[model samples]
Target: MTIRYDLPLWRPPSEGSSLIIQSTIGCSYNHCSFCSMYTNKVFRIRPLEHIFSDIDAGARDWPQAHRVFLADGDAMSLQTESLHRILDYLHARLPRLARVSSYATPDNINRKSVKALASLKARKLSLIYLGIESGHIEILKRIAKGASPRGIARAIQRASEAGFQVSCMVILGLGGREYSERHIAATVELVNAAPPTYLSTLQLDLHRAAAPGFVPRWERHGRPFQSLNDDECLGEMARLVAGVAPARPIIFRSNHASNALSLGGILPRDKEAILRTIAQARNAADSWLRPRSLRGY
Candidate 1:
């Protein structure tokens, strides 16, 4: 069997080995100033029949597959009944399929009732990747994230209550130098409020295309859009790790390819070590961090 993915499919770093399927065509909300991932395509959900065919082909090719990721931004944006049918089909066709995960926006989760979410979780649609971007409302507005910090916290809490394992992500230099302190404080506040099962941080990549939109916004507001240097970026991440105190145990990771330093471990237990590692990385020369030429979106 031959399998061809929809052009420009994306999955979380942890989903590297999962079978990929496209249940949606593009992001439901693509207006974020920092993102260029789905700007080339329009938002639309794929038909159930087409999704089923893809699953059938996937099962034929990888019968031993244990994990599956629905692609093209937020698959959770699909109607509840649609998601149910897809999950049911996958379970029937792929006996080894243990979990189904997807990127989920705050709006996507908000649109579904808690009961609806629980039902999906019961059917093995277990994990959601949520991009919180920044917990500071000002930064969120600057990035056009279309969500408030309160709203994001509520959505995350709802998902947690529904028994879905949520992996929350925050961008280290999202607020640039202008709002770094407030961004870190607010992000810590939000994370502790709705404590994710996993927390990952990625450095803000000012992709060439995104620069035009993001740069001008800063200029318009008479604020300097000064991105942090490698040392400053690491320092900001260290601050975040030091400040966050989740009630539940949360796995922390700053090992994304875009990061200046790679660190991972359960929080509180490894917090001091992670901060020490960041301090060491900050003292290192620029040559030690990931070079710009080697980075990608």
Candidate 2:
């Protein structure tokens, strides 16, 4: 008998307690106008046996790792029993395992009962990366997020209540120039609604060919985009930081490479300083230009 793996697993830049497990192949809601990350593939979950074997292999090679991050768009799509089994296996094999993480959609989260999530949390399935994308219902619909602002809020609230640390992600320039202010305001509402322990910001990336649902219709008509300048984008981040009054200690990070200004610090205390740094950086850059990649999408 022979086994082969087709999926690719990527870890974060620096070595951390976490390791990524590519449980699913692509994104279910792959319609975001500005994204091309999973355009080439359809969403699919890996077989449970294969995933278990991979975990076993990693345990053999890197027993020191205590945190696992399920990857490839979203692992929340996995069946409830499957998720439980995976968590059980990880805890059984890696007794040192401190946490398990995954990207989750509101729809996916809503599908599972509160009891299921709490059970997973009890077994150290401790973190969730939710691409809330935008808090605006129109923006979410346009991007095919498949969930409303209310739905997103409910999902996050439930997850947090389940004893898991939630990391909610928002795209900085999601509304371009036209909707930037509304985007920011709605984001504040969204963040305030759930008040997660962590927040990450990513700037909008324009990928014309690969993303149909995400490219604005006006752009298709050859209209010039009114997207944010570096300064305005920074201002959005500043506003969100200032507005979210989470009861828990929140950690904020602008992790995406596309952002002109990278900012990270603990919330409530460092939020003001983080905004000031972004403001300074934006003033220095003056002209916020987009970056280029190897494939040139």
Candidate 2 positional error at 226, Å: 2.8
Model 1 stretches with alpha carbons more than 4 Å out: 208-216, 220-222
- lDDT by residue (153-172, candidate 2, tens digit) is 99999998888888888888
Candidate 2 Cα outliers beyond 4 Å, as residue runs: 1-17, 208-224, 286-297
Against the unseen true structure, what C-alpha lDDT does each candidate score?
Answer: 0.88, 0.75
RMSD of 1: 1.7
lDDT of candidate 2 at residue 223, scale 0 to 100: 64
State residue 103's C-alpha deviation in candidate 2, in Å: 0.6
lDDT by residue (tens digit), candidate 1, 1-297: 456567887788899999999999989998888788898889998878889999999999899999999998999999999999999999999998899999999999988999999999999999999999889999999888999999899999999999999999999888988899989999999999989999999888675436344563566688768887778788888989999888998999976778877789998788998888777777776756778776655
TM-score, per-candidate, Cα-based: 0.95, 0.86
TM-score for candidate 2, residues paired by index: 0.86
TM-score of 1: 0.95
lDDT of 1: 0.88
